[model samples]
Target: FFWDRGGEALFAVNHLARRIIEAKTPKETEKSNNPKDTLAQEGLGILIDINGFQKKHIENIHAIAYMMAERARYFKSNIEIDPMPAFERRIVHEFLSDVADLKTESQGEGLSRRVVIKYIGAI
Candidate 1:
C-alpha cells in the first residue's frame, strides 16, 4: 500500500512489521540452531523499505552523526544525541569509529538508549 505520510509512516510500518513477525514466530524456532530460524528470531531479517526511504533515512542519520561529531570536536566536549534505536546507534558508532580524536558510546537504557560522542585529544 502506498503511504503518503512520509518518513513517519514508513517508520510506523516497519515497526509494526517487526512486531507482527515477532508475534507470529514460533517459540521453538526462536531457540533452534538453524541460521534461518535465528535470523527470524532476531527480527533484523525483515525490513520493508518503500522507494528507498530507508536508504535516505540512513544517509540523513550519517549526516547527523557527522555534524554531531564535528560539534564535539569543535567544542572539545561530549555531545549527547537524542535516543535512537540500536541499529541507528550502531550506525553512528561505526560511522565515527575511525576518528582519532573522538569516541562513540551508547548510554541510557532500553528505548532511551542513545549515542554519545566524546572529544578526545587529536592524535
Candidate 2:
C-alpha cells in the first residue's frame, strides 16, 4: 500500500496543527479517535507548533538538529530526543552527518527508538 503521496501527508499535518492552534475549530474540540493510527495511515508522524503560530511536521529535521546542537552545546553533554519514527530519525541523522563537532546516533528499539546528539568539539 502506498502511503503519503509525495509530501501531502506532512503538509496535512502542518495545516491541521495550524488550525488547532488558531482555535478555528469549534468548542467541542474534535479529536481523532485513534490519533496514532490516523497518523500511521497517513504515513506521517507527529506535528508540533514551532514558535507560536507555525506548525511543522515532526519530520522537520533541521529544527530537530538545531535544537539538539543547542542542547549539547549548553549542557556540554549528550542530548537525547524523544522517540521518533525511523524516517524522521533518518532525517535527523542525515542532517547532522556533516557537522564536525556533533555526532548522532540512534538508540533503543521499536517504538522507544530515539536519537542522541553528542558534542564532539567546538565548532
Candidate 3:
C-alpha cells in the first residue's frame, strides 16, 4: 500500500497489515505451491510505504543513534534512548556495532523497549 503521508497512522496500518499477513500464512509443511505464495512466505510480500517515508524514517533513526553515541562518548556514561519498536532498536544496534568504544543494548519490555548506548572507553 502507498500513502501521501506517513506518521503514526501509517505506522499503525503497516503494523496491522503485517499482523494480518502473519495470521493468514500457512505453516511450513502446508506451504502453497503458488509462486506468489512462495514469495510472500519468503518475506517478499507487498510493501507499505509513503513516498519513501520508510527510508527517510530509517535515516532519522540513524541520526538519533549517532547523536546518542556522541553524547555517551562525551559524558563517559550510558545513554538510554526513548522507547521504539524492535525493528528500530535493531537498526540502532547494527548501526553502532562496529564502534569500538560503544556498546548497544535493548532494555524494557514490549512497547517500552529502547536502545541504550553504553560507553566502553576508547579502544
Residue range with the least summed lDDT across 10 consecutive positions in model 1: 1-10
Per-residue alpha-carbon lDDT of candidate 1 for residues 1-123, written as tens digits (9 for 90 to 100): 445654667777778888888776656534877676666666555667878878887898999999999999889999999999886898899899999999999999999999999999878
lDDT of 3: 0.85
Q: Rank the candidates by lDDT, best first.
A: 3, 1, 2
- Each prediction's total of clashing residue pairs, residues at least 3 apart in sequence or on different chains, is 0, 0, 0
How good is model 3 by TM-score?
0.68
Spell out the clash pairs found in candidate 3: none
Q: What are the candidates' C-alpha RMSDs? A: 3.8, 14.1, 3.9
Candidate 3, poorest ten consecutive residues by summed lDDT: 1-10
Candidate 3 lDDT tens digits, 32-96: 98765775577654447777887898899999999999999999999999999887898899999
Say which prediction, candidate 1 or candidate 3, comes out ahead on lDDT: 3
lDDT of each: 0.84, 0.69, 0.85
Error of 2 at 38 (Å): 35
TM-score of 2: 0.52
Candidate 2 residue 78 C-alpha distance from true site, Å:
0.3
Off by over 4 Å in 1: 1-6, 26-30, 41-45, 82-90, 97-100, 105-114
Tell me the TM-score of each prediction against the true structure: 0.66, 0.52, 0.68
Report how far residue 110 has shifted in candidate 3, in Å.
Answer: 2.7
Which of the predicted structures, 1 or 2, would earn the higher TM-score when compared with the native? Answer: 1
